[model samples]
Target chain A: MTYDPVLLANIDKKDSHTLPVYQSGGGYRGLRRALEDMSPADVVELVKQSGLRGRGGAGFPTGAKWSFLPKNHPGPVYFCVNADESEPGTFVNRVQMELDPHQVLEGTIISCYATGASTAYIYLRHEYPLARRRMQAAVGECYAAGLLGENILGGGFSLDVHIHVGAGAYVCGEETGLIESIEGRRAWPRIKPPYPAVEGLFRKPTVVNNVETLACVKQIVDRGADWFRSMGTPPDPNDPRDPGSFGPKLFGLSGHVNRPGCYEAPLGITVRRLIDEYGGGVWKGRRAKAAIVGGLSTGLVTEAEFDTPLDFSAPIRAGCLGLGTGGVIVLDETYSMIDFLHNSCRFFAHESCGQCTPCREGTQWALEMLERIRAGRGRLRDLDLLREIGETIGIMPGTTICGLADGAAWPIKTALGKFREEFEGYVKEPTTV
Target chain B: MNVLDAETRENIDTIAGRYPTRRAAVLPVLHAVNDRLGYVPTEAVVELAELLELAPADVQDTLSFYGFFKQDKPQGEYRVWVCRSLSCAARGGEELLEYLCEKLKIRPGETTPDGRVTLEFAECLGACEAAPAVLVNDTLYGNMTREKIDELIRRVRAGTHHDATE
Candidate 1:
């Protein structure tokens, strides 16, 4: 590898999760720099200059998101770390939290400082008990070391951080849904006019960022924006607002691979290179048929589009929503497309928050159609009906309260369109359901 | 009768104080009771409602929204969640579940006759690199196999699930 890994550097070290080991490698230097040298506005501007984007599926610019908070909000502001990584085929956040928790904690403190947030909460998934234990230990260490409570390192900024473990609800991974869960309510996502930045987390200004996104915040403070921008795809010169993917990303590899694990690589590596080079090619020397490159929601990638760069913008051109989380699940020749689609659709169907009719009913209906097709009982129009449900259910179609519908829709719609022949083969008999 | 004792009440109070609103303590309180008793009983729900200053129906409403909390009865001491998501599924996760079910002689959501372990299928344990991962309560066991399952079960039966993870 040409470039050195920043985020995952400490993961392999023994006791790397401890505060001493983390500090020995200059861990809190990023927070120290932010608190000692930079003002809140300057810290936010530096992050904006770094061009860091959210790594939790959505590729939104992080610094611009922090700037959305009301400059003079009378009440205390809140920051939420979205550690609810329930996305299938994605587990890098879990690895980060469990192995090198201080980085996450340091990043959280810096994020709170930059956003003027007095309190922060990491909404960790209930399934991640090890991560919770490690993070709890790390948070305790920080408070004891004068890096968390009241005046931090003689800097006047005071911040309180808490870890709120979530029950098993996939919808809580959504930003608004996450806010709802934090408020101790159902994980149903709320409408976005009074966005979380404006009215969120107990009706105060809130900024919800992903784990990887915050790690980038610490790195940006440690190394200048130019150093961070040396790697990754540069922003579009013609398109003014496009903040291109910069810095190293944790692209996780699993399914039909010889060595299944998370590896740090630049953002623009092609899906084929990711699987063959990093993942040690497909196991059993099998040929790759298709892949869900970015979790289940980003849709499937067929052989023809495998060479598409796994950057923020390029995934859409390959028929996915974007490079969501960069979690690649490759399907080899033996794996059935129908079974894979059914499983992916079933995940969304089971996990919908039931707040909207389109997602609640459409996801279930889509699953039924897939089941029928898998059982050799599908009609040709059923495929068209599935496509219709996909088009009508998600945020892209303007029919739901949140993007969960959009996530559910992308793969079902994309798979039906891209793998038309395979789907058509199952629907040979024109039988009514 | 209030099922929550003084210790549970104290824990709930401290948790409620952590958040600005008493309502925000609902999950923490519920999780605490659920983990301790191995299930959130209906009686405990009403008791927790009073503690958190929430209505009984509101508590039940929120509790019902999540899949993790079991209200009917207490599960076994160990809750084994086997991953069956796409990444795990592609690598024999379904078969692994079936194998565990057959060996335990109990289906998903059912505890063993001795009430030692409760079996369930999980979406994804997020340890996908380990492919077919099995989560026993808080600890995740990766790269599962029949031998590992046998050792884990033996350890669980002996009341030492954390010992000899290999």
Candidate 2:
């Protein structure tokens, strides 16, 4: 019922090469209005009113992010779409860019116009060459339609979008790290305070929003803010002030679930509903033993909280888990949770970006502990040490230069906290059947 | 077809203009060449390096650094890339990849003798849902199994893959 017919959002996977097709489907109409009708400040105001947040992971308000640009700073501002989607379970942005490249371009253009940014960059991961090609073609389509370049839409406003493919690095998904990668440096995060909004991308004021966040701009402008606010969960009685904080999130369902794919559901949909209703339940009628709600890094929720709503705040408050990236990974009865944790810890360890001491050493220590435990070579104290290390590094959120430290630390801590019995069970039996 | 098409060549030139020095366009030029030729050959690498005013070794280094570029040989016309990261691996990707190699009658890194298909191992293709998934050339196939891969390869080889939309 959350699916709106008006906002079905066509995925032009076919014939993505033509401008006529995109234009026929009401493309460039958002950009057209932004250029001719809305002034820069006016556009920013509309976004602020819309209550849109960044769809990447950190749910920062999109308009507030745009408004973060210092007005007194007498220089050029930039918008870098964080298309560097190297998150483990998050691949929603790739489809958003690939299926509707023009939509993304339009949103980027509108954002650039609103932000008074003459230049915008889509920093994509290098593995996504197909997406890079499609984005480039979409940019070309925009230019051909006179929606970009000099005097766009006869508004005397010129904007340029450059697609920069990043070399493979998970750290680059972090906004500041992405800016560094775009600036032709190593893909490690910079310290905040000098956040990307204040001083980013060649040391100028820059706003980095996720690809999905940018893509949502067109819908907000075209349909108006009230329309978007209508779809998501009604404001909770608990939080009357920010009822519409989290909107419809695209859940990337993976693992042993049948019909596993990206399902655009409202924020408050339950894990059980997503499994039974949207995903057709577990594959081959297998019992769902564990479900990693927000990716491998997020806590593995067991049978206790299966009916927990899959929103940001609810899962955090109830089950101590946040919907980071909205990646729901269902594990069947046969899968080994310890092995999976071991594998995930290895990934975090490998991609730590080596910036801070806690993250660099803590991630390595976690993986090593997981490896030893998985290999049936660990003492009970080692299990305690795993919990200790995870907790010690968990205190440093946004403490390191980038979020990788937090990314590596938080999941381990949460998993240890939630699944201590499972870890302990692994110690005694080695194989829990 | 050795040279890029007119439009593609122009696009490559535009990437070249982005860098202050031409030598910096090596990676971008390699992408253009790969997009055109399906894989970067020795001749294309030499030509690109020469065009970018760098040693061939520089281009080779970049190709090796990234899993996308193939330097030793050309992948077949149909390149099936399976993601081999943690999520996919946990979701039975190893078995699926093994099944693909057997069905294709080539190793994971080898192209079929007929030049019709090539199997390459990718790390986290961003399509975790498709877990045990493969990208046959540009099209993404997800929720895959050995039987599914077998049927797909058969249809592709027989030229009956009418649904091949990249």
- Candidate number of the best lDDT: 1
Interface root mean square deviation per prediction: 1.8, 3.3
lDDT of 2 by residue, A1-433 (tens): 4464332256733564457767778878887787778888888988877777777877677898888888867767888888987777777778777777877788888898888787888888876756777888888877887888888889898987888776567777888877766654456677678777789887889989887787678778887777667655555678865435545677778778887877787677888888888889998888988777776556667756788887666666654436677777887877776777776788788778777888889889989888888888767888788777766663354346666666666567666676778788888768732
**Model number with the top TM-score:** 1
lDDT of 2 by residue, B1-166 (tens): 4454566556766886754456546656766778677778887777676666778786676555455677677777777888766568877887788778877778877989988888877656788876876777657787788778879888889877753333
Residue-level lDDT of model 1, residues B1-166, one tens digit each, is 5688788899988887768898888888889998688899989988888888889998898899998999887998899999999999998899999999999999999999898999999988899999889999878889998889899999999987662221
RMSD of each: 2.1, 4.6
Please identify model 2 stretches exceeding 4 Å from their true place.
A5-8, A12-18, A72-74, A233-246, A319-321, A394-399, B1-13, B19-80, B97-121, B136-139, B147-166
For model 2, what is the C-alpha lDDT against the true structure? 0.74
Error of 1 at A139 (Å): 0.2
Full-model lDDT for every candidate: 0.89, 0.74
Predictions in order: chain A TM-score: 0.97, 0.94
Given candidate 2, what's the lDDT at residue B148?
A: 83
Classify candidate 2 by CAPRI docking class. acceptable
DockQ of each: 0.69, 0.28
